[model samples]
Target: MSSIWRTMRGIIAATALLATGLGTVALPAQAQKVLHRGNGAEPETLDPAKSSGVPESWLQYDLFDGLIMPDGKGGFFPAAAEKWDISPDGRVYTFHLRRNAKWSDGTPVTAQDWVFSWRRLVDPRTMADYAYFLWQVKNAQDITLGRKAPDTMGVRAVDDYTFEVTLASPTPHFVTMLHHHSTYALSKANVEKFGADFVKPGNLVTNGAYMLAEAVPQSHIKMVKNPHHYDAANTRIDTVFYYPTENQEAELKRFRAGELHFTYEVPVSQMQWLRENMPAELHTAPYFGTYYYAPNLTREPWKSSKDLRLALNLAVDRDILVDKINQRGEIPAYSFVPPNTTNYTQQIPDYARWTQAQRDAKAKELFAKAGYGPGGKPLELEILYNTQENHRKVAIAVASMWQQKLGIKVTLNNQEWKVFLSTRDEKKFKDITRHGWIGDYNDANNFLELLRGDIGKQNPSAFADPQFDLLMAEANTTSDTAKRATLLQQAERLMIEEMAVMPLHFYSSRHMVSPKLIGWVDNLQDHHPSRFLDVKP
Candidate 1:
């Protein structure tokens, strides 16, 4: 009986060791499989040409192929195109396609698709708000403005697989721009098949690693792997589910309940608990963007006095807001462009550099200058803020500060995001509106270019300056990086000096992920998760 017991123990020990070895063994040829992703918002549209939201853009990247795509490490790589070349004058670009690439429909992807997609984007009839992104392409502005026909636009199909494009100038970032969803290709057949309903989940065709399996408006969206994809071997995930919960607390709850694989915006209130319990799961990255108060410069009281704007800018304590209201990892911003952005220099001069006490004094002096003071003539203004808790808290804090320091009565108006955007677009808000601008790319041009009256005129801010416009134009055309940086820095200084917009804080996003997830990296330029690169258990 003792001999039998010893034999049994030895057999069990050997089996356990063998199992451990198999678990750790590396396979040279077999590809790892499947990843599941959770999103905080439902995609508005899957059609690459129309999708503008971050969630939509993320899914679009996996469903469609662009001429070029960012590798999430600062460089652009060919996607549909196997190779590309630039002309000596930098006016023309030619793309060569890979022979193996094909659409999910099994049709050969041709240059004609590229030509059609480009023309469609710039067509005034399409009314693509994002068409401005393609301005570097030759004749794009002309096509958008109805000055030229779509065919006259400088993109053409040289052959079934070769595409050619002409640019108005030597844009070094042109390839990087192509990586954006605005440059994604769409099939003419799919467009015709679904017509206006092409973006509908069931009706759409995918050329990416996954296809939209289901999408319920404002609720959830699910995507399943595309077996017909060109690189199916690399695509591990069978399905991805997106839940559009706006509440940060609710997202964290779902994450803790094991219902969500990841949550992007962890609530500031839970930061301490998360740090103490699961520090390894927490991730943070500087978002290349700014949150600011866009004063309606074209309207009454605010428009009448530059000092009033300067006073208001000085009155708001950015440090307090960052530390108290937004406990999330946000940096106090003194300038429009976030630090570390390409072509950005910290040399830009800040206008309102007053300390807390000095700021209060300045606010009082400005109120008195405007013919209003504490217990005297009351200056009542409505400050608009988003419905988000953090935004509302910041608004309340600013409102309280104005009341306490400047003796101004500020009424806080909180609205849902969609309504707030619509109200701002209508330009009906004559006082001030809170807004945030997340960078579309890694360039300072993303933030700096928005302030240009040419772009802002359509959505005009209350303030406009010819000098600022001229400086930006000079910077835009100059190929020399140092010269352009200097010009942009000068323009930023002038903007802050003029009190054009009250710069508040630059965002830093935090995420909580399950231990099972891996290969995910935080992108500072855009917070959207790179679904293609991440792997899950």
Candidate 2:
């Protein structure tokens, strides 16, 4: 804890206005009953289907409710839909919508709203990054690929209060998929009437516990309780405020100074300090995420160089990188799948368990096989990463190791968040760039699908092994849990051996929580919607 910032109450009070200086006026502290928390960064977009970042999720989960929502445990509870039933074959699901559910504008939330949202998501014009998530639905892939019309999507409105979904196969995780933000219902009237302004304060009509009151980019967002929400009476917090705090240290300072009630992340450097001073406030939970670097397989040099890719993956000392650079309780990732993933058992490659010297020898052998040697010719490649203190340190360390071990000249490139996302998505980077995949659902398919050939633009690495694709397809359609896990594990092993992407570390959710906060429970997903939380006076 930074006690110095806590003591400087006068400075905090003076800068309060300046800190929130975008285009909106901050509500007077005395008049507003609001819970304030730190959002990781400026939201790229608020459109649930189109948005693809963590910051947006923090707000979206509160602004809208899907058919199902996480219950602060691994299991899920109904949100918009009161209950649902599945057929014996598991191909069809019938959702029973709550009759009292209404949008923020007091209009009845009907089954048609969900149908409209699902069609909009799979429409090619929307260019939703997570559209692949709907592939399990009947004709969803063909619809998104432009072969079929969006209306042909599997979701249908049986009536105003009845909704049905048809799947291409018996997907065990289909219900859990409804918990994602992309599956939330959208207001057809509001979207058409407001156009791009539909998400704005007055234009937006949501059905969650809170509605977007105001949003000032790069500054803050204010959400007030929605009177029309079915369960709004249970929402203890009348209002909630989210601040964009990219710098973890600055976020911690704000939390200490009473400017923020909670933070999604804390700087790794200050973890020890927080544990020593405020152990109860520091919360760490297992997260389903993988941090890796995706090498551009469509570009030259790397496009034809398999041995070079192997050498690079082998040279990385993940243990050292995780301990010294990212000391935030992250585990060095030898495989993409993290521990305790649903149904799947972790598999570590033989090379990952080898001694440092043994791995170096193998890397040298691979480089030599590729006709590149330390004295003969120097191999050069550029590593691109987003602008973060920890990322930079890790990149530098990895570069130094490559230089010393393989005599490869490595250059580091840094890009801002939005730019980095564009560069990676556009596949315009020269060599390799930093990448990460947080599970959309509690299934291995979410991570494994990234390497699939038909995954669209998200497959930046351009890795398409026919064998790997076949295994993934089999795993998707397989209903037997144990057999499905085997197939998925085999696909993962193939991906690792091919070095499609270099898995650096597995993440853990490390956040600063206020003691006054209530209704927070650490879960595997690490999701805590503001609607479920209340602040103590």
Best model number under TM-score? 2
| Candidate 2 C-alpha RMSD relative to the actual structure | 5.3
Count steric clashes of candidate 1: 5
- TM-score (C-alpha) between model 2 and the true structure: 0.92
lDDT of 2 by residue, 18-131 (tens): 657853755456433568889887777888988887888878889998999876555688999999999999999999999999999999999999999888988998899888
lDDT of each: 0.73, 0.85
Evaluate model 2: give its lDDT.
0.85
